[model samples]
Target: MKKETFSRVFPFALFMLFIGLEEFARFLQGKDILQVGTHAIYWIYPVKAVAVGAVLIFFRKHYREMRLGDLGRPTQTVASLLVGLGVFWLWVNMDWSFGTQGAPSGFNPNVFDDTSRTGMTAVRLAGAVLVVPVMEELFWRSFLLRYIIDGKFSRVPIGTFSWASFLATVVLFGLEHNYFLAGMMAGAAFNLLLYYTRSISQCILAHAVANLALGIYVLQTGQWRFW
Candidate 1:
């Protein structure tokens, strides 16, 4: 169990560092070390994406044990997709204008850089839709969700539920995003999905579905704040 725990944990801890890495880039931009516009984002997303890739590679064996191939039943996939979309709907409406501090600004490809606007937007969207969901699911749902419930989390079974683990994951997951309230709502939904399906693959698929919708919505509406 210790070996298995290590197998699941090490990569996830490293993966979470992407948030800090981006914040560091933002700090550099703040200090005038890096340009505010595209220059900062250009380095941020790609580096994080690369880091996610590296973690996957480093833990390839254990990652495989994660049973990514065992995505979920067809019914589970369909239901999760709908849930994902529902979360997106709730997310867009749950802004801070009511009272809360607004979510931190998300990636904005248009005003941020100029060299290759179209290409940069493509990369940004791709990373958000493709890369972010996979990495986050692996760390959050596949590992942290159970790990928080037990030391030998792997034996705990997927969809294992304890109020402590569920709420802890929900709050922490919510805090990860800029939109505190909406993120909290989304976290709740995703956590429920894991509970319902007991499949990391389904959780990943659901998250990917949400991100894809969000990417498209952000692009079409020019709501860069959601990026």
Candidate 2:
């Protein structure tokens, strides 16, 4: 692919690759390939965060669509924040039977004792609220959404809408989450926000807010499944 495409896709791809590796490690444990005492699978989160976070930082300058100035308007900024809070509310409540099943062990940092748990949880939370929003917006919104509108994605205007791109992004984004319905709701909300403000930074702000709220909720309620 082109350099622009690589810059946008690589971090997201690397993040997913680590996720795949985590699952593979779980599978191997289930099959007795790795003894329970020897398995350091939980470390995968920090490692994944650092690796993908580094890539995102390296390509930060390439993300022209993520201009922080784009979010300068008060009305749009408030709207994005409200939409994010609304999506977070919907997300926690939408854990219905139809949603994908939660992982059998949902990122429990408590597996390690106090200090380690706190450290791991902090890393995970940072990854979710910080790195993830930027990475996902770059991939799901800045790249794929526009790419679906045209192969020459850089040529397409930011937030340019089409039924095919909108619907495809909505469905695929939903599938990316365990809470499929909530994911779809969040995807639609973000997509609409993009259309309204034509700003990737706005979507990132919304996403970060949603994740921050979810992280607080999980910590408060010990709802590891939501993390």
Candidate 3:
């Protein structure tokens, strides 16, 4: 991998590891990672979440080479945001049988719990809203998408298209999520935004909008499974 690819990917790799850490923490304590942990969430999440914070700080300005400027032209920005909303609506409706089975019904903050005890739900909402989009955008669109076209990814233009590479990236992106179908569609939408606007930041904004809506919906309806 190129230096830029490595840099862009490192933080995201840490994030993936952090997910495992969450599971490990829960497993070690005999608690369910998916459920609202009355006490387990307090120490396990905050402590491990610090590692993610550190990784974020380390890569704060690392993707400078990508030039993800101005979040695309005005038209692209509006379109991407609209597409994001559309993705959110579609995401909730489609649950592929091959994808994840819904989580066992569990405690959701709005209904069975609140932010008072652990504040984990609130923290997760913040992450979904703020950090996740930025991290995934740079890794998947700016780096991986272009990286697939060429190892010297920076040489590949932001919007460069290759059918095989694009589809592969979409599949990989889809596999990353619990809902394969929706995730693939979401990936395609974000990838299209990158292709159209030629702006990594636009993809970032689009992803943020989608996740923000998902977070809001999850919080409002006590959809702990989605969280």
Give the top-scoring candidate (lDDT).
2
The TM-score of predicted model 1 comes to 0.85
List candidate 2 stretches off by more than 4 Å. Answer: 37-39, 101-104
On the 0 to 100 scale, the lDDT of residue 117 in model 2 is 86
**For candidate 3, lDDT tens digit of each residue in 128-218?**
7667887788788888888788888888887799997789889998877778778899999888878788877777788889989988887
Ranking by TM-score: 2, 1, 3
Encode model 1's per-residue lDDT on 95-166: one tens digit a residue: 666524444657666654466667777777777677677777777777788888886677878888888888
Native-vs-model 1 lDDT?
0.74
Of the candidates numbered 1 and 3, which has the greater lDDT value? Answer: 1
| Backbone clashes counted, model 3 | 0
**Ranking, lDDT, top scorer first:** 2, 1, 3
TM-score of 3: 0.83
lDDT (Cα atoms) of all candidates against the true structure: 0.74, 0.89, 0.74
Write model 2 residue lDDT over 135-209, tens digit each, in one string: 999999999999999999999999999999999999999988878878988999999999999999999999999
